[model samples]
Structure formats: structure tokens, C-alpha cells
Target: MSDEFTDFHLEAGHAANGPYALDVDPQRAGWGYSSLRILDLPPGGHHSFATGDSEWIVLPLSGGCTVVAGTGTGTDTDGTFELTGRESVFSGVTDFAYVPRDTQVRIASGAGGRFALTGARCERRLPARYGPASAVPVELRGTGNCSRQVNNFGAAGTFACDRLIAVEVLTPGGNWSSYPPHKHDECRPGQESELEEIYYYEIAAAHGKEGVGYQRVTPSGHGRGTDVLAEVRSGDAVLIPDGWHGPSIATPGHAMYYLNVMAGPGETREWLICDHPDHGWIRDTWPDQPVDPRLPLYEAPAGDAR
Candidate 1:
């Protein structure tokens, strides 16, 4: 890969700094809004930080944690939220906590776990709140080999945020997700929205063996025209500045999971994308095909659809 592509793909441990196993901010990513950090805490460990000018979601990758939000002055408190996280990314839908900008937050893990701090630079300081696991909208999308399950926990309209739009996707082994290349690099009113994105991946293991997946991002005639084709593994991440990214393919025996963190300069916090014209027609065929049986690896609470 060329320097541009390599710059966009971060291998496991390559982006680690201090307590974060992985960290990417707007300055580091060459963008203005999106950022992500993975915090790996040992059993009974705790960490604290200020939110700065970004709104953040404390989403667990495994285990559970208690999030306490407060003002740094020691006289005011936002609130405390207990997250009963799952065992792993493939286990089930996990709960998350939202901490607004300009506040101090602390996370404590009793049994230890990997947690994702999905963030976005924003203008408003929303109230701190808890998001229950049962409130997530589990959406089964695509069909057949393109099938995937989406946990829209922080997606726009689901959970309120100023600019952060985050979601988790699970693709069965041998299948693909984020297919039929799409781009949100242009602000076309109702047609599309300009946004920078981050894809954080985790591939499930089998028989004590590791797994892998692929990610591709092509030029979309916007900005610097980001291009990337990466062989990704657990803890790896891909940044999308301006490109038509798609076909995140999982190898035959390994289930793939990815957390998408998106934010941009647009006024509205929405996730509207324009599909690559050549492959846009694929959506039309999904109506006639049967969704893969392995979809929705786990179900959310009944009637809790968002």
C-alpha cells in the first residue's frame, strides 16, 4: 500500500498511547469531528478524563463498568450509570453511557473489560445519560451473503447526541457487511451528508485460532480522495475521510464485528449516504432474497425496535 492508504489503516497496537489500546482524534485522523478510543482496563481498575469539546459514548466491548459523570469543581455531579456489558462482541447487545462535553467522567470496571469511547467534536453540551441494552435497535440488514446485524445504539434518532453517530455491525463468517460501496462525503441536503467515519473491527476466534477480514475504500472525488484496502484483525481500525468504502468481507470461518463512529460538519446529526452508482442496484435485489439464517446473532428485547 502507498503512504496514503497505510496512513488510514492502523494495525493492532500501532495506535496505542498511554491507557488507550487504540486512539484516533480529529487531528490525528486529518479530519475535524470524529474520534475513537479503546480502553483496556484490568480487573477492578478505573480511569478518569475530561470530555473537552466532544460528546462521548462509553460502549463496552466486553465485561461491565460503572460510569460517573461530574463537573471537575467537586461541587456538581451529572450522574452515575452502571453498564452491564457482555462477555464479548459476539455475545449480545451491550449497554452504553453518554457523557456530554465539558465534563469530567470516570469509568470503573469490577471484572475488567475492553471499552470503546466513541466521540465527536460538537457544539452543544447534552445532558449525561444511560442507555440500556434493551433500548438498542437490532436491525437485520441485507440478504443472503450480504446479511449483517446492526446494533444501532448511538445512531441518530435512536439516542440523542449533538454530532456523534455510532453503531455496531456483525457479519456471519463467509459473508460481507458494508457492501455495495457507499459514501457520505458530500452534503447534498436530503440526498447525502458529509461525514468522517471510523471502523473499529473485532473478528471472532475459532479453535484457538485467530481470524481476519478485509476493508476497502475507494476515491469519491472529494477532498484528498482517501483510498485504502486493508487486511484487518481484532483491534485494527480504518479511517474514512472521503471515500466510497465497502465490502468489509469476513473470511469463511470467522465472524466479523465492527463499530462505526461517525461525525461531520453538517448541521443535522444524520447518517445519509449515497451508494456507489455501479453497485447501488444491489439493494433492489435484496427484497427477493432470503436473509441469511445466522443473522441477528442475538436478539434484543422484544418490541423495543427503534
Candidate 2:
């Protein structure tokens, strides 16, 4: 790949910084709003940081943790939440905690696990709160080979945030998710919203073998163009500054999961996208086809409100 594409693709361990196993901020991504960090803690380990100017959500990739949000003065406390995380990304929907901007946040895990700190620099500082796993809307999207499961825990309308919009997607092995390439690089009133996005991937292994997948991003001929075709593995990430990104395909025998973190300069925190015209017709075919049987790898926990 060329230097430009290579710059957007971060292999596992290439983006690690300090206590995070993978860290990508607006400054490092050459974008203005979105950021993501993956923290892997051993048993009985803890980590803390200040959420300066940006709102954040502590979503677990694996394992559970207790999150405490407080003022940096070491006196006043904002909130304390306990997350009942899952065994792994493919296991089930997990609860999370959100901390507002300009606060000090600490995370501690009794048994140790991996957590994702998805963030966005925004204008308002919302209150810190806990999100229950039962409240998340589990959606099965697309059909046949395009089938996938979506955990809309932090989607635009599902959960409220100032600017950050995050969600998780799972594609069964030999299937594709994020298909029919789309872009949100322009703020076109009711048509589309401009947003920068980050895709953090985790492919499930089988019998001591590592899994793999593919990601593609194409230029939209507007603003600063972005293009990439990356072979992704666990702990890898792709930064989409502006492009029609999609067709995230999982090779046979390995499931694929990705956490999508998005934010932008638009006045509204919406996820409206303009699909690639040539492939947009694919959506019309989904209505007549049967959804892949492997979909909904797991469902929302029992007693889900939605």
C-alpha cells in the first residue's frame, strides 16, 4: 500500500501508548472529533485518566470493571458505576459507563479484562451515567451473505450524547458487514451528516488459530480524500477521515466484530450517510432474501426493555 493508506491503517501494537494497548486521538488521526483507546488490564489492575474537553464511554471488550468519575480536585465525586461486562465481544451485549468532559475517571477490574474508551471532543459536558445491557437495542441487519448483528447501545437515537455516536457490529464467518459502501463526509441538511469514524476490530479465534478480515475505504472526490484497503486482525483499527467505507468481510471459519466510534462538526449528532450509488441497490434486494442463519450471534440479556 501507499504511504497515505498505510497512515490510516494501524496494525496491532503499532498504536499503543502508555497504558492503552491501542490509542487514536483526533490529533494523531489527522481528524477533528473522534478518538478511541483500548485498555487491557490484568487481574486486579486499574487505570485512571482525565477526560479533558471530550466526553467518553467505557465499553468493555472483555471482562467487567468499576468506573468512577470525579472532579480532579480529589474531593467531589460525579458518579460511580459498575459494568457487568461479557466474556468476549462475541459473547453478548455488555453494560457500559459514560463520563462527561473535564472530569477525572478511574477504571478498576477485579478479575481483569479489556475495555474500550470511545471518545469525542464536544461542546457540552453531559452527566456521567450507567447504561444497562438490557436497554440496548439489538438489531439484525442485511440479508444472506450481508447479514450481521448490531448492538446499538450508543447509536444516535438509542442513547444520548453530545457528539459521540458508537455501536458494535458482528459478522459471522464468511459473511460481510458494512456492505454497500457509504459516506457521511458532507453535511447536506436532511440528506447526510459529516462525521469522522474509527473502526476497532476483534476477530474471534478457533482452535488456537488467529482470525482475519478485510476493510476497504474509497475516496468521495470531496474534501481531503481518504482511501484504504486493509487486512485487519484482532486489536487493529482503521481511521476513516472521509470516504465510502464498507464491505468489511470475514474470512471463512472466523467471526468478526468491530466497534464503530464516530463524531463530527455538524450541529446534529446523527448518522446519516450517502451510499455509493452503484451499490446502493443492494439494499433493495435484502427485503426478498432470507437473513443468514448465523445472525444475532447473541441477543440482549433477558428482560430487555426494547
Candidate 3:
């Protein structure tokens, strides 16, 4: 039951517990690295947790909150950060807070909302920090139908963490993202990494209609045998401990969004990956096609911080 690839598919409400709407720890995932937690807070509600051996990022899926973080051994227990979150994950990029390992952090909100806690286990303890929405790099990738907007919020080299690498991706309705199926199940020195990955989805419902999407994961014959084909929706999730995964399809009527959390035991914090040979050639044709115009959805308002 704990096999990462065998227990890869998790429907909404399957992982719920307490204040956490969904919880996927490394042990449950069988990868021993990455994890994800979705917290639902009510008006004036709060939740607290110890970082322990993992570094975590507090990203608001909707609404705003205040974060107070401190280490048990440190004298300064007043480290507070205000995240001016937005209407929804589909509406705009949001501010976030990074909690270092072995520390304690508390989250309090005057208004209720859902938040994503993306994490990774690591031995190194980095400094607790806050990242503004303005600082997040927005990138549009692929071509035409394959086009998708990527928010490299906590991706490696962009944000400093001991082992965590998190990113948000938005795919337009009827489009395909995570294309050219890629695999990182091997540490090939300069080519690939052996990271474990988690995909948490949040599909956008339009015109009172519900949202739906699909995901696929096939075996890579490297670590574990894996095969999955799943219907994903808001609050749904999938784990990829090892395999060639990709081509996450957004249904015709729904725009899809997913938060990716990844981590590995490689010597360096890297995100190298190998694209599936059969589909890798698709990248070469991108130059001939036009980028999707529906991209860059909900750019943050020009302001101090939002």
C-alpha cells in the first residue's frame, strides 16, 4: 500500500486529516524524499507545525495569512511574514514563506482559505525566508496546444532550499502540458537526477461547470514497475517515485493547474531530466508553431507586493 507507484493515485478526500485537507508524506509515498500537504483554515483559524527534518514552503491557494516562524534554540521568536494572497491559484501568483528544518512555524488567517505546504526531507537547515509574488519568475513553455504557463516559485536556483524544488503550472483548456514525457529516475552525473515527485492538481471550473483532467505514468524499468492512467480534479493528486511521466491533459472545458514538489539525494540540488525518445522530437517543432495567447493568465497587479 505504501509503494509510491502502486499508491500513485489519490482522489480528493482520500488523504484528509484534521486541518489538512490532504497529506502525502515521504514515507506514505515510498520515495523517502518529497511530500505535500494542503491546509484549510477558517476565518481567524490557525495551524502550527515543527519543520523537523524537512524544509517547507507555505503557498496560499486562495486568501491571505500571516506566518510566524522561529527556531527553538534561537532568541528571536518574532520572525513574522504577511502573505497578501490572491483570489485563487488560477487568478494570480501568490507570496510564500519558507520554513527551515528543525524550526517551528505558525499560520494564522483573518479570513479562510486553502494553502499548499510543499516539502522535502533534508539534512541541511537553511534560513527561514519570505518570497514576494513579484520575485517569482513566470515562464511560458512549449508551442500551440502544448503551451503552458509555469510559475517557477521555488524551483532550484531560483529559491534557496536544501533539497526542495517546487513549481506551479497552468494549462489552458483543451491543451496539453507536461509533454514529451520526461524521466529523472537515474542520477546520470550531468544528465539526470533520481528525485521523487508529487503532482497536486487544482482544475478551474468555468460557467458553473465542474472541472476535470487526466494524467498518465508508465514504467521506466529502472527502479519500480509502474503504470497509471487517472482522472484528476481539484484536490486530486498523483505520486511518481520512478517512471516516464507526462502529457497531463486538461479536458476541453477546463483549464488545469498543478503544483509540483520534487526532491532527491543527489550530491547537488539539480533538476536534470531525460525526455522520452519517442516524444522528444516534439520540442524541435515548437519553433514553427505559435505560442498560446491565453497564457500568462492573471498577472499580478503592479504594486509594492501582492
Candidate 4:
């Protein structure tokens, strides 16, 4: 809605299909990076992309596919990357990897699948390559309340990059994530890290029915700010530049999945959020409760499209 980003609402899938969509030109959304889109695909069908000014990440949302990433800056021999999309990876959910700008990347599905992808202009300039495996792994620290796998961009300095740090989180149904209502929009080393953030979502289907998820971000009113409390199904996204956000409330029907893409002017991408001073005491309560039983590590038959 601002000059910072270019908006694309995108078309939704059929009720028989799953809720899946792609987001691009994050800067238009006030994001410092660029993005791409993903949905359903037919066998032998392929998508080719020319990297813009910023780098991009090429991840598969669902079903596996083959990709060729290279410096094919107008030529065909730059080289290609062959990857097998996850067999059980929900076909229309989750993200892949960060794609560097100016590179030529191509993707072809083995049997045609669906996916959700985001491409951001890379501030941390670096050379483009195919299948550059260099994301540092970090596990969620809290209890069963929510567990996730984080790609520590700050730790994995494999490429000379800047302006963005990305992380992927998976939450089981009924389980709560983004607990404690934390915010990392302000950069304050060891105290409060600052950075504008965006939440890109992909919820897994359950028992032949679609799954649902929600996210909330509210401003503290130190000045003129905004608050967002949205019911986000798969493919939908919410932007959060400044505020106290948390309790990524999930429904009891099914588990959820989402990818968080964040970036700020500062050099570090570490997250630092100040909780609602009144609710700051909740972090202590997590150790006592059991995570929601509906959360899914892997559910099949798929739910309805969001």
C-alpha cells in the first residue's frame, strides 16, 4: 500500500486444493527485500526467474521439484542445481532458501506440485551460486509449547550479505508459538534487537480438511502506530514494522506452519522484542503446561484450502 512495496493479491486454489499463494517485491510492502510466488504446477511445467537488484531465496512449498540456479546471466551454461523436493513435504506449504539477485534460476516439478516462495533484494551483496548449502541450524529453545528449526543468517555468514535475515518455524496444531509476545523491530544489542519483520504463512491440511492460523501485532502508542490481528490461512501474509506481537494463536482443528522474513538497517538480524509489560509474566507458565495435542508433525488427507 506504500511506495516501499508492490502489491499482488494473487488468485486462490480450489476448495478441493489447498490454500497456497506467493508474495513478491517485499520492499513494496515496506520490506527491504524482494520475493516470489508459488501454488500448483503441472508435470514438465517449469518456472524461470531473473533475479532483480536484490538476491532471492528459492524454496519449495510442497511436492518436490528440480531446480537449476546459476550465473546464467543471459547464457545457458552457467550450471544447474538438481534438488528433489521433499516427498512428504506438504505440496503447498513452507519456504525454500534465500536467492541472490541477478542470478538466473529455473524450477521444474517431477510430477507437478504446489509451493509458496519469497524473493528479497539482498542488501548483503554476494556472488550467486547453485545450491549453496550454508544455513546455520538453530533449534527452538522453549518446551513442547512450540518447537522449530531456525536458519541463523547471522551465524551462517557463508556469503557476504546484508539487509535481511530469514528464519523458518513449524508449529503443531493447538500448540502456541511466538509466545511471550516478543518484538524485534528495534535494534539494541543484547537488550533489544531492531528490525522490521514480515510473516509469510503456510498451514498444513488435516483429516481431509483445511487448517487455519492467526497472528497479531499491536503498537504501543508511543506515537502514531497500527495494530494487526488477522486470521491468516495458507498463502496470506501480514506485515509488522513496529509493535508488540505474540501468541500466534492457532485453532484446535489443525497444526500450522509459517516462515518469518525480517530485515532492518542495523548490521545484526538478531530478534529483540519487548513483551506487553503486563503479560511478560507468562513465559514462566510455559514450563508447567503440555503443548496442544492437535499440533501435527505430519498430517495427511489434507484439509480444505484457506
Which RMSD does model 1 reach against the true structure? 3.0
**TM-scores for every candidate against the unseen true structure:** 0.95, 0.95, 0.95, 0.74
Looking at model 2, the pairs that clash are none
Segments of candidate 1 deviating more than 4 angstroms:
1-6, 72-77, 302-306
Error in Å for residue 302 of model 2: 2.3
Q: Residue 222: error of model 1 in Å?
A: 0.7
Model 2 regions lying over 4 Å from their true place: 1-6, 72-77, 304-306
Q: Per-residue CA lDDT of candidate 3, range 48-132, in tens? A: 9987789899999999999988844654433678999888988999999988887889999999788999999999877778888
The deviation in Å at residue 64 for candidate 2 is 0.4
Per-residue lDDT tens digits of candidate 4, residues 69-147?
A: 6655644324455544455343323324445656666777768776545444554546443332223343443456554
lDDT of 2 by residue, 274-294 (tens): 999999999999999999998
Query: Residue 263 of model 3: what lDDT?
Result: 95
**Measured by TM-score, how close is model 1 to the native structure?**
0.95
In terms of lDDT, the poorest run of 10 residues in model 2 is: 1-10
lDDT of 1 by residue, 1-306 (tens): 322234899999998878999999887787799999999999999999999999999999999999999854444238788988999999999888999998989999999999999999999988888888898999999998999999999999999999999999999999988989999999999999999999999999998999999999999999878889999999999999989999899999899999999999999989999999999899999999999998779987544332
In candidate 2, how many Å is residue 71 off? Answer: 3.9
Worst 10 residues of 1 by lDDT: 1-10
Q: Quote the positional error of residue 21 for candidate 1 in Å.
A: 0.5
